[model samples]
Target chain A: MSDRSLSELGEQGLLPLLQAFCPAEQRGDDAAILTPPAGQQLVVSSDVLVEGIHFSEATTPPAAIGWRAAAANLSDLAAMGATPAGITLALALPSDRRLSWLQQIYQGLDRCLKQYDCPLIGGDLSRSPTATLAVTALGWVNPNRVIRRSTAQVGDWIMATGTHGLSRLGLGHLLGEWTLAEPLRDQAIAAHQAPKPRLDVVPLLARSQPAGTVWRVAGMDSSDGLADAVLQICRASQVGAVIEALPLPATTSFDRDRLIQAALYGGEDFELVLCLSPDWAQALLELLGEQAQVIGQITEKPVVQLRLSDRTEILSLDRGFQHFTTH
Target chain B: MSDRSLSELGEQGLLPLLQAFCPAEQRGDDAAILTPPAGQQLVVSSDVLVEGIHFSEATTPPAAIGWRAAAANLSDLAAMGATPAGITLALALPSDRRLSWLQQIYQGLDRCLKQYDCPLIGGDLSRSPTATLAVTALGWVNPNRVIRRSTAQVGDWIMATGTHGLSRLGLGHLLGEWTLAEPLRDQAIAAHQAPKPRLDVVPLLARSQPAGTVWRVAGMDSSDGLADAVLQICRASQVGAVIEALPLPATTSFDRDRLIQAALYGGEDFELVLCLSPDWAQALLELLGEQAQVIGQITEKPVVQLRLSDRTEILSLDRGFQHFTTH
Candidate 1:
């Protein structure tokens, strides 16, 4: 376990190898016995954002990389109505990369943590030939206000914070097919890069604490295409959804076809999905004000259909970035 | 965001890309809500055992790969006096490998989990050019008995559970130096392949739950070499130690010079370093008996020194396998 070079030793060698060198206190324990401040439950989640699978070679920036890592995890806590706490980044990259890029990456992470008010507690850094990053964000949840996707019921009006598809536009720009002006381009790019996690809105949602029984948050982040996200919600809640196409927050840069596609498929929106009943919608709106808009309704039909203004036309898309799917 | 492919998306895209796809419930909530029933305060630890790094190319078997992944993480839980619960694996592998090999890898993992009585909960699987496996094992720590390294006091007796250096012996066998019988060779190999995480012993120690004052099993695990581990403990507790080398388990497979190196530096002993008052040693033995042995006493000098039974031996060794020295 301890003798040979890594290439000669392989995975099995780690136990004995580590046993020889690692401190007994840190070594024997399952997890480090963190001396957290009095009364803090460990917050945790694991995310693997793959390269060539999730992003492209052309456009992602180092800071954006850093910001989004925290944002995705932070968003999860938000949906659960939990406060952002500590984070761990388990990153895998090629061994040959320069240290500057890594420092810049951390810089981006620092920016996000400061913005979200989350602390960078721990992380694991490793090298791989291909770039891959897995981060597990830990946060503490208030015992009462924990939001879950399973709590949403059939009658709740579905709502979302922020616009969809701007990230896709940024991606388009990266792909060279689209030309965008400065502010709009920056906005679109920011939607993809340095996307904000709604830590601010979670506590507010908790105060109103809209019907935890039926009218609740479900599914999660819009990183997948909107249609795919709706499908996930349906799968998790075991109900169908009828999303009104016109009500979706639209962007000016897209044509009708592209706009609808982005609404349906363009993702990385980092929006909140709130499902509430008719009477509670007003209460929720008052609590939330203009943070979001009513976009759809939950259904039992087990189908995700896009409803048109005509009421007769429905749109359906077959493909979006399913993690299991091969391109 | 969309359509740019993975490479163009780059490193800093973790947040947006992850936010884009992961379902809200699973993505970034404060902590993953494992809703069965929170009986024990959850103990969590993650180890990213990398390839061409932690292990060797020659000795790494699929079964060993699988086995060590579970064993390494479970050992930490055991160190905490925690019962192994659910385990999650995030695996990144090189493509173009056999499906059978992958299946065998799981077979090894399944063996450890089943034997240790922990269930496989959830996981993330993907491909990487370099083989990397990260395992997070969750266990339950007794609220009152959660042992920590910093809690070790000034006069604590340092002891180790089980013998050390067997893993190095097995590595020697694999390298064709250990001319042993098949059973002994297998034993060494198994030591490397599947570390016996002392779960049963941990709970027993917790139940015994010695004095309110003595060091409560501080500075656990044998990741780095024993001396390095001792150094870490001293640094954490802000003290020093004189290790009795005779009681420190030595092996026969290595030659005189090699034996000393292996015994002192060979990692992965998976032994517990208990910090107990000398008064409690007898009671601990009444409970743990001969499986435990007093090896040293904590000192105030803030320096770690080794004592040899023969001739107050002078040593010529400090450089050890530090996992990565290349960078």
Candidate 2:
């Protein structure tokens, strides 16, 4: 084994190693000035995905690893209603990993980014004992349609794009919270590995007219599930919410309480939490019929409650996700 | 000790980690989007400073750790002659470090950012086995004068901001390079620890207009030494360079060969490497007289050579930072 120091590994190991894939077009420039076909706003965000943390050593497939990495950043862009443009990957790998795994990650990122028309522009490569990835993605957004996390208001209706509890179910399967059979296991694993970030309704949501611009429900990506997203929307927009029991789209075969909890705190469901004025909700669903549905409504009160019955509202047992603390 | 897993970091950590000190007005938004104060265009760049390798675990103090982290990003802004604005710190700390030390890094960053009038805007923190800091600083540029790294042309003069070989020299001293006298050791330690990022030249250089636009001379921050930066400049701008043996500015007692080598490739100098028109050389110095000076000029051969004497020209070594290949 080489007794090379970290700084030496950092300086020497990373810079030259980066030449293997990092394009020479951006050698010494300050930042890769990504010019989208002009008239496009830049959608930018950063995420840190860690090993044995974001994924376990044995369970994380190389392709999945690569896909999820791009997925997380794309989700951020989708949260902003931005069209995926380009990405830069900063990876910290152990010295001993097979080069084939690295190639797989590249391939995975290439595939997803290509789907979004976002190219991997530039990145930094270095060695650390732990496997880590910090990805910064840039996307294009039209000014009128960019969504903010602070737009949801009291009296507005709440909505989630798709099923909520499945990803948590998927995670439950990953962390061994429950055992899943093959087709079942594959489905859960797929949910865990390749979350489809919603980018389809951005233009519609962005151009949703006066009510959409004024009292349109604000949004945040549901990495921590719809209920937790409820809390986040509540906190950011300064409004509480009452999610309807019958309307929530969730995973089948999930326990009621666990399903509620998963909807509240189970992570990585890349759905949008839209809080629209009750009057506008009907028109929105009519316009966005198949793409969205009203799942709840905003309340003036600060407590995030669930309405199982008119007089029997149940408060969430978990207010937020603490993946490290409880799980 | 709590056995919190990485996911427990949740969206934010469970334990109410000390909140970031971003201005209240800038916090809680989808992202911190700043409108440049009248007459300023935002300057932006990012950098990653890793741990266990950048500094010896022994001598890198908390304040220096924080200071260097901010300085690394600030240096990039300075090279572009941009006025610092705000920064986001993405920190991944080793699980073993004390919260108190983590706080001290904040202390160091606060001092540096405050000095540059750059406030902490926002950041993300996570857990890992080794510390790593990814810093992205926002700055203001004079729209007409944003410098780039690919503009250095043939016959342009090459200039650097400060002396070289000091950061690693200080590192060497801390790693027991020699039994240093107190004052000497202190200076070396300070250089290694809180290396100055020259932000004092942005307006001066803009006023100087050394070239058509301040952007005319391609430039970048010198993390590695002067020669290494020169090679990067040569490679990016597609040119070559020559240096007079006696014109290098270094400390009186510095070792000539080591000084040259470090100047060539001792990373993290955090200075500006500029390639400008020869006529702009004297004007550049007049503008940045006490701040930066004229170091050398650009050439056409696409090689870095040193002129030792009338009949002695030698091809310089391009081997200071070779990081990737190890057997």
Report the C-alpha lDDT of model 2 over B151-246, residue by residue, as the tens digit. 788888777776666676777777886444566566667878998887776666666664444457577777766666777778777888876642
Best by lDDT: 2
- Among incorrect, acceptable, medium and high, the docking class of model 1 is incorrect
lDDT of 1 by residue, B1-327 (tens): 233433333322223333332334444332465432244566667777777666765667888888888887887777677777667666665544444565666778888889998866545555555667777777776566776665566787787776666677677777677555555567767777677776767766645655565336675665555555566577668887777753344444445665556555776767677776776655666777767777777888877777766534322224445432341
- Model 2 lDDT tens row, A60-141: 6887788888987788777777777667777777766656667677777777777776766666666667777777766666
Backbone clashes (count) for model 1: 63
- Cα displacement (Å) at residue A141, model 2: 5.4
DockQ comparisons of all candidates to the true complex: 0.21, 0.33
* Cα displacement (Å) at residue A231, model 2: 1.0
